[model samples]
Target: VLVCLILRLSGNVGAAPESALITSLPGFSGAFPSKHYSGYVTIDGKPSPKNLFYYFVSSERNPQLDPVVLWLNGGPGCSSFDGFVYEHGPFNFEVGNSTGTLPVLHLNPYSWSKVSSVIYLDSPAGVGFSYSENTSNYVNGDFQTASDTHTFLLKWFELFPEFVANPFYIAGESYAGIYVPTLASDVALGTKTGAKPIINFKGYMVGNGVSDPKFDGNALVPFAHGMALISDSMFEEAEAACNGNYHEPKDQKCSNILDEIDEALSGLNIYDILEPCFYGSAAKDDERKNTSSLPLSFKQLGATDKPFPVRKRIFGRAWPFHAPVRDGIVPSWPELVKRSGLSVPCMDNTLATIWLNNEAVRKAIHASPEAGEWTLCIDIAYTHDAGSMIKYHLNLTAQGYRALIF
Candidate 1:
C-alpha cells in the first residue's frame, strides 16, 4: 500500500524507477525523493551563459497535479540551497568532527514537497554553485533579479513543458518579501507566447517580511513591549523623545530606548546575533549548571564533531525547536540594499514614502507592466492587529494582488 501510494504520488508507478530513489538519509525518514538538475540559460543572448543549479524534491506518493513553489532566500547573495538543506528540504546536515560531511536527514512529513513540488534555485549568479566568468554580469539588483527570474521561469517551462500549466506560487521570507511581490507583479503583467504569459502564478506567502521600513521600525517598540523586552513606560518615553522618528539622529533618546531593549534581549537570546565566535563548552556548562530540566551530562551545545565548528546552537527547549530570531527574519537592510542596487540611506526613505502615500499601493501595482488586472485584498484587521503584520503585506495588495494576512 505504501509503495502504491508513493508511486501514485510521483506519477511513476511502473517498476518504480530506481533512479528516483537514488539517495536516502539514514536517520531521516520521510517520503520525498530528491533529484538535481544543472543547465545554462542565456541571459542576454550570449553564446555561453553561466550554469545554474536546481534541486527538485518530489513527494513520496504518486505525483498529483501539485503546485510548484520556487523558494528564494534573501541576501540578494545568499543561497536558497542553504535554506533547503537547513529548513524545509528532504535533508539536513548532521554533526561531524572537524570537516566531514554528515549524513542527510530524510524528508520531513511536513515538508512542502508533500503538497507542492518545491524548486530551490541558486540565483543571480555568484551564489553557491551558480557562477559566472564575467564578473560584470554577477552584480545584480532588484530589477535584474526579477528579470532573470522571469526569464528562468519561461526557459524552465520550455525544458519541462509538462509542468507549464501547473499552478505556481512564489514563497520566501525576509528579503524574499520584496522579491516575491516584485516578481509576481512582473510575471502577472508579462505576456507569454506573444500574447499569454507562460507562468501560471497564483498567490504568494511571506513571513516576518520587511516591507515598509517606517512601519517595521515603528512596530519594534510595541513588539518589544509585547515580548516583555521593554516596559510600556519606556516605550512611551522613547516615543515622545524621538518625536515618533526612530531613524533620525542615531544618537537620540529614542535610539537609547531601542538600545536598552537590545541590551536586555542580548544575552537572553531573543535575537540571533551572527557573531564570528561561538559559545564554547564553558558557556554551555554555565547555562546547564543552573538548569534542572537538563541532565548534567547533556552536551547538546557542542555535540557535533564536524570538520568546521558548528557555530549555530539549536535549542531543544521549545516547540519551534530553533531560535525564532535566527530564522532570517531580521535582515541587514544596508547589506540588502548594497546587493540590490538601491541606495542604503534611501531604503528607509523608500519605505517611508510607501507609508505616506494613500495611493502608494495602487501606484505600485500600476508601476508593473505585467500586472494588467489587479485587485486589493488587504486585511485591515490583520494589518492593525498587534500580533499580525499588515504593513509587511500591503505591498502585494497595493500591486492589485489578493492577500490574507491572518
Candidate 2:
C-alpha cells in the first residue's frame, strides 16, 4: 500500500533509470518525501566492465534546482554507505530487537538530502556492492580509482540527465581525502575538454581529510598532547627525542618513546578520545592493553600483537586505523592488515552489516544478490599512485574550482 502511494507520488519521471527508482524501503513504512534511486554505473564499459554501485537521494527541498553532491568514504576499500547509513543519508536506522532481525529506519532530519541531492557511491571495484568480472580490476590504485569515478560521473549523468544541469560537488573523508581532489580535478578538466553531458562542476569539500604525508603523518602527536592524552613530560620527551618528528624515528630512543605513546593511547578510542573505548567483559588484561587505533595511512605509531573486542563507531572525529605501508605503497590486505597493533576497521558495524545484507533491503536498493554479502570494509590491493594531493588541489583551485578543507 505504501509502495503504491510512493510510486503515485513520484509519478512518471522518465529520465533516470526507471528500474532503480525505489518506491518504498523495507523498514520505513511512511511514504518517501524525496525520490530515491540505487543502481550500478559501469566504468570502462563492456566486455569486462567495472560496476560501481550508487545510492542517490533527490533533494527533499527542491530536486531540480538543488546541488548534486557525490559522497565517498575512505579506506580505499570502505563503502560510501558508511556515510549513508551512519552519518548523513536520509535514514536513521535502529538495530533490530534481536540479532538477526532487520533494523528499523526513520527519516534523518539532518540528512544532506534535505538541501541538496546526495549520491553515496561505492567506488573502485570490490568495495560494497560494486564489482567487476575482471580479477585484475580489483588490484587498483588511487589514479585509476579517480579516473574510474570520473567515468562513473559521466555515465551517471547520462542516466539522470535531469540532474545534469544541477551544480555538482564531490566530497569525502579519510582515504577519500585522496579520492575527492583527484576526481574533482578530472571533472574540472572534463568541463574544458568538451566532455559530453557536461555537469555544472562547482566546488568540493573534505572533512578531516588526509592531504599530504608529511602533514598527516605528523598530526597525531600534537593532537594527543593537546587532548591531554599524553602527559606534559611524555610530550616534552617525545618532542626532544624525536626532534618533533614522531612520524619517523631517527633512533631507538625515539622508537621507544612512540611505543610508549601507543601504549598510553591504547585504552582510548583514537577516532574520538572523549568516547569510552569499550572492552569486552571477558577480554584479558593483555588483550585490552594491546589494542591501539591510529591514523589510517600514518602507521608510524607502532604495531599491536593482539586484537580485542570493542564497539567502534564510524562517526568518530579522526580517521583511526593504522594502515602500515612499504615503499609508500599501502600493502595488500592480510599483509599489512594490523593497524597500529590493532585490527583494521576497529568499528562495530553490526547494524549496517545486517541491514545491507538483508534480502528485502538489497531488493529495494536495487543491489543484486549476486553482488554477494556486504561488509563495511573490503580488502582491495589499493596503491597510492596519485602521490601528494597538493598538486590536484592547486590545479583545481587555480581553475576557479571552489575547495573547502576542514
Which candidate ranks first by TM-score, i.e. highest? Answer: 2
- Candidate 1 residue lDDT tens string, 1-406: 3533554467541332233222433334454364433334445524336545455565444334678788876544555654565457655444422222233344455567767777777665555445555545555556667767777777665665445556677777654655666676667667433523356667777754545445555566566667665677877877777665654424556667656655444333322222212333433343333222322222334343421112232211110111122222223434433455422111111111121121432232122212122111100111111222343346446765555321
Q: At residue 318, what lDDT does model 2 achieve? A: 28
Off by over 4 Å in 1: 1-42, 45-50, 62-64, 97-99, 191-197, 249-251, 267-406
Give one digit per residue, the lDDT tens place, for model 2 in 1-406.
Answer: 3532443456524589789999988888888889999999877834488889999999999887799999999876788998998888898887565556787888988899999999999987888999888767787777888889999999998898778777899999877888999899888888889887677899999987778766676777888889887899998998899887766678899888888887676545555455444334544443344344444323433333322222334423223222122233233223343543444434556678888998888989989776789987776677777778888898888989899998
Residue 71, model 1: Cα distance from true site in angstroms: 0.5
Please provide TM-scores, in order, for all candidate models, with all chains considered together.
0.61, 0.83
Error of 2 at 238 (Å): 1.4
